[model samples]
Target: MSTVLETRNLTKSFGEVKAAKSLNVGIGKGEVVGVIGSNGAGKTTFINMVTGYLAPTEGDILFDGQSVVGRLPRDITRLGMARSFQVAQLFPKFTVLDNVIAALVAAEGTKASFFGPFTTAARRKKAEAVLEEFGVANYSRSLVSTVPQGARKLVDIAMALISNPSMLLLDEPTSGVSIEEKFPLMDTVMNAVKKHGVTVLFVEHDMEIVARYVSRILAFYSGEIISDGPPQEVLRDPKVQELVIGHHLDISILGDAT
Candidate 1:
């Protein structure tokens, strides 16, 4: 597959601390890649820089071969890249449908006013379609704060997908979800993204989830990528096991899950 995203010598530093080191990585089109790291690792920093949430102290980022280093987050979104946070970013007070309508308005690059009617019938129908696309239509009229955690995650992902992005960066998609719900939640997300042929880069801590969903793994240690390869190979790497995974796991079992 052709390269969809590339970071060349990417570096981000906050004063004396290096959140991201001189990193170079490339993600191919339609690849499902998992990012794993400990607390101080640069996983989130990498996502932030790529998504334009943080300016890189050095180096460049390219989305589909175009430099997005200095682009605004919305501008990057307009370029067909979208991201969901570890904590679902949603309008807590808005009805789920209304939340999606707001996203649709922003995706269209139209200025949305507090007093204006942003939700036309066509927009509402589109929002409903998005809700159904992620299997969250059942919560269409419910407040975002009142839904289950899994539903909230789906709602956030649905909002991201409404923009029809070619590449989606998901920050810990299964965080705060119960174990029984994690697989189903990931299944829903993977299915939706695959339907759109979207490339995915997700930060995940769960070994099973990472092994099951991603074709490749990127393991970060202290702001640097220490391992990058197929899931089984990276998972079984002794250094990765000691520093990241923190214990030996039978890759055969994880492979079976995949």
Candidate 2:
């Protein structure tokens, strides 16, 4: 249960608006935690800060027992932390295999060889292997824009995981996926991450998805965490029910799911 990630009084503000306020939490090694909230509830803001996409206005972020306060996103990734966005981050015009190869280059921190021979046979084999691992090998030769949303998501996550990070943060992992595709998408992701023994923190609006995958939940409102604990406990809390879940989820059914 050693902590892999921690935030101490973390705060982020844009002008007079405070997007995240005095946040504090600890995620242990190999824990799969879910972050839930209404729109603009600071979930993404917290993710951005932790991943170094946005620097905190005050306080600190510690990853693997060291302060990462002023580090850049690439530096954080190199330190064994990686994240996938709410929107799949991929090159639309590139084939899935090529995109993965590009990600591999970035993960290796090698200078891009734009003028000549960027994709070596070794790189292609590795990229194909990663694509196969993520269950997106069928789309390897397809342009990313032509692939289904679920497959695109898998590729984006595959790119993030190419560096073999110890901790993986996913922002709205199932967003834009159809109802029929959600469970299968998450199943693939959870299985792959579990195989890698990576700690996971994901932001999601789908209650069913959250209830099914996460061992613990953090509910946010007005830029603050109102409840944090096991899914059963957090989902049943009066404050969390009113502010976060609202009419979207029926808590009684979720008792057995978590």
Candidate 3:
């Protein structure tokens, strides 16, 4: 795996508060990396800078060996990267099918073309296939407002996938999803990413999910990476154990493995 993304001494500040403090990390292609941090640890800020949503106060971000410092988010996406939000963003009034179709339509460049003839019929069919792949085929005709939060998240991710991104940045994919539906949701995401060779970098608080899904974990504390390694190593670290993993995993979850 080659380095697909890298940050050099990345720093950010808002007014008098420091959000990120001289951080550095490298992410390889096809790797699923987890970022765990408490509130105000600058996790979102870090994502923003990487996605070109916010310019860093200092340091640099390189994607695919090129600087992405001053580009816009859309510009970044056009370069084969897409990001999903913590709270799934969807056009509530639109039917699930339309929301996805809209993304497919938008990808072809016109928003109000209503005629649906921007791309070849083959491409439109491809978008519909993606929706079916995520198990949203049944909700295709339903309104986003009518669907459950988990389904909305699924649809949102499906829309992002329709773009065929090489790297996916997910803020919190399982946020509103029910516990029972989680594994299936994760299965869909991981399967799609792996089959497509899409790299993933996400922020999540759930230790179990990180352990099961990501190959590496990056622990952020007060705007800095305190630990980075395999799940067992990072979670068992005294530093991470005291901070992020404290409440989530007790003696029971970690057990004699300690």
Candidate 4:
């Protein structure tokens, strides 16, 4: 229950628009906090600032009680915080084993030694273990092109997990996967992350996913947090209902089955 991440008066602005406004939030080790907000609610902006993709206009971010305001994304990651992109980032032509080895190499400051002994038995064993946890070990020798989009996402999550990050920042982890695949994928993720005792902060659109996975919810609207509490309370909040959840859950998507 120790504090893992904390933000104080966090703010981010792009010219006339303020994407995140005076945000203050805290997450503890092993906590899973869900972020729900409309498209322009600054959920992504908040994440960008925390993960070092964007600098805060004012205020500070503390990771494990240390200031991290001016650090770069890679530096932030090296310090045990890893981020997952909304779109799956993978090398389509590379073998699954190679893709993971590449991440390990980069993590070890040997990204330049692609074909070197960097992919030694030890690294391969580690990479293979992550793949197995994601249920994609069978596809280790397969090229990325041959895998399904859902599996690709699992791979992306596995890649992030391989870094052994202490805190994970995921932007819509289940964005492109099918409804049937979502729970299983998340199960894989939850189990693996829990094994590492990592804290999670994620932006997601699905209420069902939020209820199923998150221990708490932080709802945002127009670059501000409207509610921060348990799933039931946040979902039942009037401001959250009117601004983000209600209208959003009713939207029509091509694959509404998910």
Report RMSD (Å) for each prediction in the order shown.
Answer: 1.2, 1.2, 2.6, 3.7
Expressed as tens digits, the lDDT of each residue in 1-258 for candidate 1 is 899999999999999999999999999999999999999899989999999999999999999999999899999998999999899888899999999998888888998795787889999999999899888899999998999999999999999989999999999999999999999999999999999999999999988899999999999999999999988788888989999988656666565444
Q: For model 1, what is the error of residue 132's alpha carbon versus the real structure, in angstroms, after optimal superposition? A: 1.0
**Candidate 4: pairs in clash:** none
Give the alpha carbon lDDT tens digit for every residue of 91-180 in model 4. 889988888888777667665654556668899999998998889999999998798888888888888878889999888999988989
User: Candidate 3, which segments miss by more than 4 Å at Cα?
Assistant: 108-120, 250-258
Evaluate candidate 2 by giving its C-alpha RMSD to the native, one decimal: 1.2
lDDT of 3: 0.83
- Model 4 alpha-carbon drift over 4 Å, by segment: 247-258
Greater lDDT among 1 and 4 belongs to 1
TM for candidate 3 is 0.92
* Pairs clashing within candidate 2: none
Cα TM-score of candidate 1 = 0.97
- lDDT by residue for model 2 (51-157), tens: 99999999999999999999999999999999999999898989999999888888889888856668999999988988998889999999999999999999999
TM-score of 2: 0.96
Q: Each model's TM-score, in the order given?
A: 0.97, 0.96, 0.92, 0.93
